[model samples]
Target: MTASGALDAPAASRPMPSLAAFTQRLRDRLIMQEDPATAAYDRIMRRLGISIGIAGIIVGGVELPEVAEQGRYAPAWWTVAAVVLAFGWYPIIAVVSAVSGPRAIRFVCGCAAMSFLGALASIPFGLKLHTVDATTVWPFRVTALAVTAAVLAWTSRVTVVYLLTAATSAALATVYTVSAVTPQHVTENFLRSAGLAALFVWCGTAATGAAARVDRESAIASRRAASQAAAHSRDRERARFAALIHDAVLSTLLEASRAGTKSDVLQRQAERTLEQLDECRGAQRDPDLLDARSAVLFLRAAVHEINPSIRFATRTWPGYDDLRMPVHSASTIAAALTEAVRNSLRHAAVPGREVRRTVTATVSAGSIRIVFTDDGAGFDLAAVSADRLGISMSILGRMRQLAGGSAFVESQRGEGTTVTLVWGGDGSR
Candidate 1:
C-alpha cells in the first residue's frame, strides 16, 4: 500500500470505543506522524553535492596554471570550461534533487555522468602537457571526477552502476594519460588509477549497504510497534469485558442465592440482570465523543495495568472532568502518558534500591498535563541516545503531532526524572 493508505488503514478498521480500538487509534496517529527520512536524505545529498562542487573548483584551479603556461593551445579552453561547468552544475542539481520528489535518485546519477565528462575533458590538456613536459603525470586533473563518483555512490542505491562507471573512467583516463606521454608506462598508470578508483567505489558500496540497512531497520521497528500496540489494546479490552461480566452476573447470582423464591426479590433481580446486559451491549459503542472524565479514567486504567504498585497523584481544577477534546488528541495524550510511566518503571531506579514513581494528570480550563515523576536515578537529557524512540518518537513526537501540544523532560543524575506533556486541543485555547 502507499504510505498514506497504510497510515489510514488502521484507523478505518478499528473505530474507537474499546481500549483496543483506542490503542489502534494511537498507533495510527503515530504512523501518520511526519517521518524524518526525507529531510535527512535531502540534507546529506545537499552537503555531499556542495562539498564536492567546491572541491571541483579547487581541482580546476590546479589545472589553470598548466593551461596558461602552455601558450595558445586552443584545446586548453575546452578542458578548462568543462572542468568549471562540471563543478558549477553540481550545487544546482543537488538542490533540485532535494526538492524534486521521486526524481532525486535520477538527478544524482546525472551528476555522475557529468563528473565523468569533466574528467574526460581534461584529455586535451593531458595531451598538451605530454608534448611540452613529457615526464610529469596529469592525475590531479581527474581528482574532481573521482570525488563526484564518490558523491554519486553515497546517494545512489545501485552501487554496481557507479562502480562500473568508475572503473570505465579509470581505464579511459589511464589509457589517454599514458598514451599521451609514455606508452611504456601505461601499465603502471592504469594500475594506480584503477586501484584508487576501486577503493573509492568500494567505500561507496559500503555506504550504500549501510543506508539500506538503516532504512530497513526503521521500517521494521515501526511495524513492530504498531503490532504490539494493537495486541496490547485487545488484551486490555478483554480484561475489561471479563471484569464487567464478573461484576454484573456474579452479583446477581449472589443476590438470588441470598433471597431465593421471594417473588418480589426474584422479579427485581431479573429486571436488574436485563439492565446490566443492556449496559454491557451499549458499552461497545463509540467512545470518540467521550467527556474529559472518561478519557482520564481510560488513561488511569492504562497506566495501572502497566504496573499495579505505583501510586497515582492526580488533581484537577473546576470543570476538569466535563471538558471535551478530540478523540485523536485524547488517545495521543494517553499513549504518551503510558510511555512516560513505562520509562519510569524501566529506568527510574537507583543501583541498589527500588523507588516509587508517581504519574499525575492535571486538567485546567483549556488544557491538560500528564506528569510522570520518579526519585530514582536519572541521567542527563543530552546523554540520551538519538535511537531511543520511547521518549523521542512515542512521547515527544506524538505530542508534537497535536496542534497545540508540547513535551518537556527535566532530569538530573542522582536526583530524579520528570516528563510533562501539555496540550490544548488544536491550539485554539
Candidate 2:
C-alpha cells in the first residue's frame, strides 16, 4: 500500500472482479432494508404465483378436454371446469405479473394463463355431457379463446412471452377446431391443424419480436434518468468541501503571511494544498482517485457521470477500496492525494531551469503518486515551517491518519519540487 512497485503490477498479477460479483453487490445495497425472512417469502410467493398461472393454462387448454370428451361417457364436471377457468383465470394471474426481476417474467406467465383458460372454454360439443346446450357451450369456447388472446397481448409487456403464449394459443385453437367438427375429418383435420400451428408461430414470432424491441428502448430511457440524478448529488458534495477550504484554511494562511512569522516554504506549501482541495469532490463523492498499491485497472466508463478530463493516462493504478484498505485507511489516503496535488500545482518550480510547467500523475508498486514539477526556480527545503497549515493540516496530517504511509518533498534551486504520496501495500495485486 505504501510502495509504487506493488500498486502498478501487470494485468497477470491477479484475477479481476467478475460481473456476478458486481451484480451481487448491487443486490446487497438495494435490498429495501426489509427483514431477511420477509424478503425470502416475497421472492418465493412470486415464483409460486407464476407456476400456478402456467399450470392452469396446461390443464384447461389440453388435458381436461381431451380426457373428458374423447371417451364416449363424458363427465359433466369437465364443462363446469372449463367455464370456471374462463371467468377466473385472467384476474387470478394478474397478481403474479407484478414480480420484478427481469421484468418479463410476470407478463409471460399472465399471457400463458389467459390462453390456457381460453382453450378450456372452447371444448366443442361439451353439451354432450348434458352440462348445457351445444349452442350455449359453443359460444363460450370461442369467446373465451378470443378473450385469452387479447388479455395475453394487453398484460404481458414482454414480447417474447406474448408471442410464445399467442403462438401456443393459436396452435391449440386450430388443432381443437380440426378435431371437434361433429363428423371426424381425421386426415384433413390433421393437415389443417399442422399448417395452422406453423402459420401462427410465424405471425406471433414477428409481432412478439417487435414488442421486445420496444421494451429494450424503454429500459435505456430509464437508466439515463437515474444517471442524471447521481451527477447532481456529486456536485453538491464538491460545493461543501470548497466552502471549508475558503473559510477556515485560507483565512489562517493569509493571516500567517501578514504577521511575517511564516517561512517561505510554509506559504508555498499552503498554496499547493488549496489547489488539490479545489479539485476534490471530497470523501462522500464516489472515488475520483484512489491509492494504487493494489495495482488495479478500473474502466472509468463503468462509473456513472465522472469527469471526462479526470482519467488515468497510465493503465494501472493502486487499489485501496473494499478490496484493500478498511474504510478508515482508504479515507486517509484519499485526503492525502488531494493535498499532494494541491501543493504541487501551487509551488512546484520549473525543471531544468525551463519555463514549461505540467503536472504528471503515476502509480507504482504500493503507491498512487502524483508529481507536480515545473521549469521554475526552486527554493531551500530546510527553511520551511513544519507546522504550516498546508504541511500540518494537509500532507503530513493526512499521512499520520493512515496507519503506514508518508508524504515527501524533494526540491533544488533552479530545479522543481516533486510531492510523493505513499500508502500501505498488500501481497496480492
Candidate 3:
C-alpha cells in the first residue's frame, strides 16, 4: 500500500505496535544520532560543575581574610593570585565550558590542570606563617574539590589519575610545611584531600556512566526492533504480490484459455491484466507524488483516523490545488501532525476539565502549513526529560528531516499547547 493509503486505513484494521517496538522506534528517533544519553549526561555534569564552581567562589570569598593572613608565609601577591586563580578564575572557566561546545572540555581540563600546578607551586596548600598549629583549615583544599569535579569533563581514567596526584601532592606539601611531621598527620591529610575530591568525582562518573550504558542498550534494542519491522513489511509485501498474481494474472489466463483466440473479450481482459501488472511494477519503482488537493485530503483523513473528534479545518489559496510535492514530504507532514494530535489527547485532556482540540491546514503559494491546537492542560517544557521523544522526535525531528519543512511546539502549564508544522515553500524539492 502507498503511504497515504496506510494512513487512511481504518484504525481498527491496523495492528497496534507492541510496547517494545514503540519504545525502540522512539529511541531511534532521538535528535542526536550519536549517544543521546551521553550528551544529556554531559549537559547535566556541566551544570553541576557550574554550581560547584560558584559555591567554591563564595566559600573562597568568605575565607579571604584567613587566606590574606597567610601572606607572611608565602609572598603576599602570590597568595592572593593563587586564591583568585583557584576560586574566581576556575568558576568562570566552568561557566564558559558549560555554555560552549565540545572543544571547551579541553579548555576546562587545562584550567583544572593549571590550578593544580599552581597549588603545588604554592606548596603547604594554605599553611600559616611558620605556625605549627594543625587545626587551620586550607582554603585551597575546598577549591580543589570543585576543580576535581570540573576535570570530569575528560575521561574517567584521566580524572582518577589527576585526583590521586592532586591529593598526594597536597598531603606531601602539608607534611613539609608543618613543623612536626608524623605518620598520623600524613595519613590524615591525604585522606582528607582525597576524600573530598573522590566524592565529587564519584558522583559525576556514576551519573555519566549510567547515561552511556542506557544509550548503548537503547541503540541495540532499537536496531533489533527495526529488523523485525523490516521483516514484517517484507512478509506483507510478499502476501500482497501473491494475491495479486492469483486474482489478476491467473484469472486472465484462465479466461483466455477457455475462450478461443478469436474472443475479443478475453483479449481485453488480458490487456487490462498486463496494464495492472505494469502499474504495480511502476509503484514498486517510484512512489506517486501528491498534488496540493490530494495532500490536504490525505492529511485530513490521517487526522480523522487518529482522532475522529478533532475539528479539522483547511484553507487553500488560488492555484493551491495545482501544486505538487514529493510523496515523502507529504507523508512526513502527516506523521508529524498525527503525533501532535496524539500528544494533545494523551497529555492535554485532564479529567474534570473540558478540552477542545483543533487542526488547521493551510495550502498557499506552494507551501503547506498545519497547526494543531488544544485548549487543555499544558505542561512545563523544561520539566520534560531529554530522552522523551514525543515532541523532539515525532514532531520536530520528522519535520526537520523533510526538505523545506519545519516544526514549532509552544506550551505553558495551565495554558495550552500549539504545534505548527510547515513544508514546501522556499528550498523545496
The number of the candidate with the highest lDDT is 3
Which window of 10 residues has the lowest lDDT sum in candidate 2?
1-10
Q: Give one digit per residue, the lDDT tens place, for model 3 in 220-310.
A: 6444433443344456556767888999899988887787558888878888889988877865522244566556767787788767988
The superposed Cα distance between candidate 3 and the true structure at residue 366, in angstroms, equals: 12
Candidate with more favorable, higher lDDT: 1 or 2 = 1
Q: Against the true structure, what is each candidate's TM-score?
A: 0.52, 0.25, 0.60
Over the stretch 1-429, how does candidate 2's per-residue lDDT look in tens digits? 121212122322333257843543333222222122133333333444444455445545554554344433345665565546453453355343332321343454445446444544455545333333221233223332333333334433443354444444544443454324342333443344334534533453444445555545534533443344334434555566777688657875776767766577667666766766665534344532223432222212211122234333433444423233233444444444444443434343232332333334455444444433333333346644443345554556667666666677665433444556555544222
Full ranking by TM-score: 3, 1, 2
Question: How many steric overlaps are in each model, in order?
Answer: 0, 34, 0
lDDT of 3: 0.63
